[model samples]
Target chain A: MIGEWIRFGITCLLLIAALVGFTAAVIGAYRFGFVMNRLHAAGIGDTLGIFLVICAVSVSSGSFLEAAKAFLIIVFLWFTSPASSHFLSQIEYYTNPHLYRYVDRKIQDGPHSDEKEPE
Target chain B: MSVETAYDYLYTGALIWLSVLILFMLVRSIMGPRITDRLLAINMIGTLVISCIAVLSRLLDESYLIDAALIYAMISFVSVLILAMIYIPVRQTRGKFEKDARKEIRAERGIRGSVTESGSPEYKAGKEAEKPAYEKGNAGLDNGRDTQQDASLQEKGGSRT
Candidate 1:
C-alpha cells in the first residue's frame, strides 16, 4: 500500500509538471512578439510537455504493453516535431516580407564579419 | 482517500488544465497575423490534443484511444507538410509581383537621375528592404542545388510567374 501511494504521488507530480510546461508554452506563444520566438515557445509543449504527460500516464499504467505504447508516442513525436518545425520555419522565411527587419542577416555572412557587434 | 481515487482526481485535474491550454492555443491561432504563425499554433494544438487523448485512454480505461492518439499524430504531421507545400507556391508568386513592382520603380527613379539620391533616407530604406529578398533568393538557389524538392518548387514558381 505504501509503495502504491508513492507511485501515485510520483505520477501526480509528473502530470503537474506537464501541466506547468503546457501553461508556460501557451503564455509564451501569446507573449512573444516575433513568429520565430513564438515557435520556440510552442516547441516546449510539443516536446517536453507531451513527454512528461506520457511518462505520467505510463507510470500509472503499470503494464508492459501500455508503457511501451506510451514510450512509442514519445519517440514518434521526437522524430516528427523537428520536421514540422523545419517546414514551418521555411514557410515563415519565404512568406514574411518583413522578416529581415526582425532577423539579423549580418550573422549569415560568417561570425567573423566586419560588422560591429551590437552594444 | 484511496490510491485509485487519488489517481482519478489527478487525471481529472490534468484533463481540465490541458483543455484550458488547448483553448488558449486556439485563440493564438485565430489571432496570428501570419499564415506560418497560425500553422504553428495549429501544430501545437495537435500536440496538446494528442496528450489529452493519451491521458483519456488511461482515465477511461479504453486502450484503443492510445491507437487513436497515434493515428492523430501521423495525420497532424502530414497535414502540416501538405499545407506548407501549398503555401510556398502562393508566396513565391506574391514575392515575384512585389519584385517586379520594385524594379519598375527603380527604373523610373534611374531615368529621373534618382540613383544619385541614394543618400536620401527613403532610397536607403528601400534598398535595405530589397536586400533581404535578394539574399533569400540566392539562399534558395543554393538550397535548390542540394535538394530536388526545392529545385522542383523553384521550377514551378518560375513557370507560374
Candidate 2:
C-alpha cells in the first residue's frame, strides 16, 4: 500500500513539473517581443513540456504498451518541431521587408556587398 | 485516500489546468500580429491539447486514447508543414498593398524613370538608411531566380551574429 502511495506521489510531482514547463512557455511567449524569441519560448513546451507530461502519464499507468504509445507522441513531435521552426523563420526572413529593423543582416557576397554592416 | 482516489483528483486537476492553458493559447492565436505568430500560437495549442488527451487517457483508463494523441500530434505537425509550403512559391513581397503604395509615393515625387522597390512600415517610419540595401535585394529578386536568391540569402545566416 505504501509503495502504491509513493508511486502516486511521484506521478503527481512529475505532472506538476510538466505543468510548470507549460506555464513558463506561455509566459515567455507573451513577454518576448520578437517572433524568433517567441519561437524560442514555444520550443520549451514543444520539447520539455510534452516530454514531462508523457513521463507522468506513463508513470501513473504502469503499462508497457500504453507507455510505448505515449512515447511515440514525443518522438514524432521531436522530429517535426525543428522542421516547422526552420520553415517559419525562412518565411519570415524572405517575406518581411522590415527585417533589417529587427535584426542586423550582415551582407555577404550579394549585390549589396558594398554596404557597411550595421553596427 | 486510496491510490485510485488520489490519482483521480490529480488527473482532474491537471485537465482543468490544461483547459485553462488551451484558452490562453486561443486568445494568443487570435491576437497574434503576424502569420508566423498565429501559426506559432496554434502550434502551441496543438501541443497543449495533446497533453490533455494524454492525461485523459490515463484518467479514463482508455488505452485507445493514447493512440488518439499520437494521431493528433501527426496531424498538427503535417498541418504546420502544409501551411509553410503554401507561402514558399508566392512572390517575396511584404504586403499586397506595398507595391501600390510604392507606386503612389513615386508618382507623388515625380520620379518617372526610377524603379520603385518594395516598401514596408519601416520605410514609412523614416528609416531611409537601408533603402539602398533593400533595392539591391529587390534587384536580385526580380531576376526570376528564386532558388538562387534563396541560396545566396541562406549564406547570410552563417554570420547572423
Candidate 3:
C-alpha cells in the first residue's frame, strides 16, 4: 500500500511538471515576437512536456506493453520533431521577404544582391 | 482513498488541465499572425492531445489508447511536412513572378533614363535618396564648406569697399 502511494506521488509530480512545461510553451507561443522564437518555445513542449507525461503514464500503468508503446511514441517524436522544425524554418526563410530584419544573413552574390537596386 | 481512487482523481484533473491547455493552443492558432505561427500552434495542440490520450489510457486501464496517441503523433508530423511542402513551391513561384515584374520595371526605367537623359525628377530624387549621405562622397559637406568660404569672401569684399 505504501509503495502504491509512493508511485501515486511520483505520477502526480510528473504530471504537474508536464503541465508546467505545456504552460510555459503556451506562454512562449503568445509572448515571442517572431515565428522562429515561437518555434523554439513550441519545441520545449514537444520534447520535455510529452516526455514527462508519458513517463508518468508509464509509471502508473504498470504494464510492460503499455510502457513499451509509450517508449515508441517518445522515440518517434524525438526523431520527427527536429525535422518538422527544420521544415518550418525553411518555410519562414523562403516566404518572408523581411527575414533580414529579424535574422542576420550574409548577402550572397546572386539575384539577392539586387535588393538594393532602385525599382 | 484507495490507490485506485487516488489515481482516478489525479488522471481526471490532469485530463481537465490538458483540455484547457489545448483550448488555449487552439485560440493561439486562430490568432497567430503568420502561417508558421499557426502551424506551430497546431503542432503544440497535437502534442497536448497526445498527452491527454496517454493519460486517458492509464485512467481507463487500456493500452490501445497509447497506440492511438502514437498514430496521432505520426499524423501530426506528416501534416506539418505536407503543408510545408505545398507552401514552399507556391511561395517560390509567387516570388519569381514578383521578381520578373520588378526586372521589367527596372528595364523600362533604364531605357527611359538613357533615352531622355533628363528622366523624371522624382525618380532621380528617389534614386539619390536610396544612397546614404556618406556614400555620396561628402557632397553635402563640400557644399557647406564652399558656402562658408563664399560668405567669408563676401565679407572681405564688403569690408574693402
Candidate 4:
C-alpha cells in the first residue's frame, strides 16, 4: 500500500511539473515580441511539457502497453516538433518583406572559415 | 480524504489549469500579428490539448484516449507542414514578379538590358549592405553558371539559417 502511495506521489509531482511548463509556455508566447521569439516559447510545451505529462500518465498506468504507447507519443513529437518549427520559420522568412529590418544576419566566408582567420 | 480521492482532486485541478492555458493560447492566436504567430499559437494549443488528453486517459482510465492524443499530434504536425508548403510557392512567385518589374523599369531607363552584370560596384556594395547577411552569401553563390532559378533556390536555403 505504501508503494502505491509513493507511486501516486511521484505521478502527482510529474503532473505538476508538466503543468508549470505549459503555464510558462503560454505566458512566454503571449509576452514575447516577435514571431520567432514566440516560437521559442511554444517549443517548451511541445517538447518538455508534453514529455513530462506523458511520463506522469505512464507512471500511473501500470500496464506495459499503455506506458509504451505514451512513450511513443514523446518519440513521435521529438521528430515532428523540429520539422514543424523549421517549416514555420521558413514561412516567416519567405513571407515577411521587412524581415531583414528585424533579424540580424552575420555573413561568414565559408563553412570551415573561422572568425579569427583572415582572408 | 482517501488517497484515491486526493488523486482525483489533483487530476481535476490539473484539467482546469490546462483548460485555462488553452484558452490563453487561443487568445494569443487571435491577437497575433502574423500568420506564423497564429500558427505557433495553434501549435501550442495542440500540444496543450495532447497533454490534457493524456491526463484524461489516466484520470478516466480510458486507454483509447492515449491513441487519440497520438493521432492529434500527427495531425497537428501535418497541418503546420501543409500550411507552410502552401504559402512558400506563392511568396516565391510574387518575388519573381517584382524582379521582372524592376528589370522593365531599368530597360525603359536605358540603364541595363540584363539582370546580371549591370550594377556598378558601388551600387552592388550598397545593395549588399542593405540585404541580410545570408542573402549576401546567397548572392555570392549566384555566379555565372546558374540562372535566376538557381539563385532563388539558394535563397530558399537562406531561410533555414
Candidate 5:
C-alpha cells in the first residue's frame, strides 16, 4: 500500500512538472523565433520532462514488475537524447553552414545586394 | 473523469504542447541563417520525434514505438558524424587563406573599400551574382560574361589579376 501511494504521489508530481515545462517551452519557442536554438529547448521537454513523468507513472503502477519495465524504458531514453543532440549540433556546426543561418540573416543578403548595385 | 482517467488528459495536453514547440523549431531549421542552424534544428526534430513516440507508447500501453525511437536515434547520430567528418578542417585553413589574400589586395589597390565583409553570406552570394544570364539555357553564359568583365577590368587597371 505504501509503495503504491509513493508511486502515485511521484507520478502526480511528475505530470505537474511536465505540464509546466511543456508550457514554458512552447512560450519560449514563440518568443525566441529561431529554430537552431529552439531545438535544445525541445530536447529538454521531451527527454528530461517526459522521462520524469514516465518514471512517476511507472512507479505508481499496481504491478511492481510492470513498473520496473517502464523504468527500464525511461532509462533507455535518458541515455539516447544527449548522444543524438551532441552529434547533430557538431555536424551542423561544420558541414551544412547555410542550413544553420537564421531568417533575419537571410534577409540581410537581399538588402546588402540592393545597397551595392547603386541604381 | 476519475483519477486514473485523468492521466490521459494530462498526457495528451503535454503532448500537444510539445508538438507545437517542435513544429516551431522545424520552421527555424528551414530558414536558418546558415546550414548548421538547419541541421541542428533537424537534429532537435529527430530527438523530439523519439520522445513523442515514447509518450504515445506509454499512453497507449504499446512497445513498438520504443523500437522506432531507437532506430531514429541511431540514424541521426550517423548522419551528423558523416557531415562533420567532411566539413571542418578544410574550411578552417581556407578561411585564413582568403582573409590574407583580401588584405594584400586591399593594400595594393587601395580601393578604400566601402564594404569589407567576409562573414556575410551575401559576400559569398555576390561572387556568384557576378555571373551573367544564359539566354540559351546553358549555365555557361553567366560564367562567360563574368570572365569577360573580369578580363576587361584587369586590362583597364593594368594586370591586377
Candidate 6:
C-alpha cells in the first residue's frame, strides 16, 4: 500500500515538471523566435524535462515494453540534440557570419573587434 | 499519469533542472564569437538535452529517452570534428602569412629573409652602411672567377703555340 502511494506521489511530481518544462519551452520560443531560442529552450525546457517525465511515466505504466519505448524516444532526442546543435552552430558561424551581427554580442574585447569598427 | 513512486517525482524534478541547464548552454553558444566557444556551448547543450530526455521519459512514464541521449552523444562528437576540419586550413594559412610578412620586412632592412639565412630580425640595421663583410665576399668570388678565366685563356694559348 505504501509503495503504491509513493508511486502515485512520484507520478504527480513528474507531471508537474513536464508541465513546467513545456511551459518554459513555449515561452522561450514565443519570446526568442522559433529558431533563435527554441533550440536553446528545448535543451533544458524540453529535453531534460521530458526525460524526467518519461521516467515517471515508464515506472507508472508498469509495463516493461511500453516503458522501454518511452526510454527510446528520450534517447533518440538526447543523441540528436547535440549533433544538430553543433551542425547548426557551425553552419551559422561559417556560412552565415551575420549571426554574430544579429546576436547582440559584444565583440569589443575579441580579436574581431578590429573588424567591428564602423565600416 | 499515475506517477505512483519516488522515482517519478525525482525524475521529474531532475528533468526540469536539466532543461534549465540546456537553455543556458544554448544562449552561450549563440553569443560566442569563436568557433570552439560555440562548439563547447553546443556540446554542453547536447549533454543537457540528453539529460532532459532521460528525465522526461520518467515523468511521462515511458522509456524512450535513453535512445535519444546515445544518439545525441555520437552525432555531437562527429559534428565537432567536422568544424575542426573546416577551420584548420585557415589557421595554417594565417601562420604562413605572418612568416612571409616578417621575411619581407627583414629583407627591406638589409637583414636576411630567414633566421637560417643568418640571425636576428632587427631590420633597420642602418641604411647603406656598406659593410666590409659584403665587399669582401663579393671581391673574393670575383677574383676566383677571374683567375679561372685567365688560367683557361693561358692554357688555350700555350696549346696553340
lDDT of 5 by residue, B88-153 (tens): 565455445434543554354333222634334665355435333331233344434544564356
Best-to-worst lDDT order? 3, 1, 4, 2, 5, 6
DockQ for the candidates, in order = 0.44, 0.40, 0.40, 0.47, 0.22, 0.06
Candidate 4 lDDT for residue B65: 97
What is candidate 6's lDDT per residue for A1-119, written digit by digit as tens?
67877776776677566656656754554344324344575456656565766676676667888677666766666666555565554444454423433332222233333323111
Against the hidden reference, what TM-scores do the models get?
0.73, 0.71, 0.71, 0.71, 0.53, 0.38
Candidate 3 wrong stretches, greater than 4 Å:
A104-119, B90-161
Off by over 4 Å in 1: A104-119, B90-161
Better of 2 and 6 by TM-score: 2
Which consecutive 10 residues in model 6 chain A have the weakest lDDT in total? Answer: A110-119
Q: Which sequence of candidate numbers ranks them by DockQ, best first?
A: 4, 1, 3, 2, 5, 6
Tell me each candidate's i-RMS in Å: 3.7, 4.2, 4.4, 3.4, 8.7, 11.3
The per-prediction tally of clashing pairs is 0, 0, 0, 0, 19, 66
Stretches of candidate 6 exceeding 4 Å from the true structure:
A33-38, A102-105, A109-119, B1-161
Whose TM-score is higher: candidate 1's or candidate 5's? 1
TM-score, chain B only, every model?
A: 0.60, 0.57, 0.58, 0.58, 0.57, 0.52
Q: Write the per-residue lDDT of candidate 1 for residues B12-125, one digit (tens) a residue.
A: 888898899888889889988788779998999999999999999888988778888989999999999999887776435555644554455447645543554544567545
Best by DockQ: 4
| Residue-level error in angstroms, candidate 5, position A85 | 4.6
Tens digits of per-residue lDDT for model 1 on A1-119?
Answer: 99999999889899899988888888888877667777888886669998998899898888989888888889999999989998898887677654543334443554344332222
lDDT of 3 by residue, B48-157 (tens): 88999999999999899999999999999999999889777753555555455445644764565556433346645654453334324334544335434543564576
Q: What TM-score would you give candidate 4 relative to the actual structure?
A: 0.71
The C-alpha local distance difference test score for the whole of candidate 6 amounts to: 0.53
lDDT of 4 by residue, B28-98 (tens): 88988788988888888888888999998888989999999999999999888888898777435556544
